[model samples]
Target: MIRILLADDQRLVRAGIRGILDDEDDLHVVAEAADGRAAVAACRELRPTWC
Candidate 1:
């Protein structure tokens, strides 16, 4: 599976994105953040493929 981390201020946006990614067979959402700071922290913790 491909790990993904999403950073967005809007919870709905994040949920939508997660739904789309979750529907994919090869992609998965590993983490989410509501701010840049939180995103950075998640990046460090998750170390997603993109990061």
Candidate 2:
């Protein structure tokens, strides 16, 4: 499976992207962040396999 940490300033954009990515069996969104800083934090915390 492909783990993902999706980041976007817009909540709607993140939601939309999560929806699209979730549709695929092999693609999984493990976390979401609204900014670069948060993305980095999430990356550190989640340590997604794909990251």
Tens digits of per-residue lDDT, candidate 1, 24-48, equal 9999788999999999998998898
**What lDDT, from 0 to 1, does candidate 2 have?**
0.91
Ten-residue segment with the worst summed lDDT in candidate 2? Answer: 42-51
Residue-wise C-alpha lDDT for candidate 2, range 8-51, written one tens digit per residue: 89999999999999999998999999999999999999987655
Query: Each candidate: RMSD to true structure?
Result: 0.8, 1.1
Against the true structure, whose TM-score is highest? 1
Query: Deviation in angstroms for 47 in model 2?
Result: 1.3
lDDT of each: 0.90, 0.91
lDDT of 1: 0.90
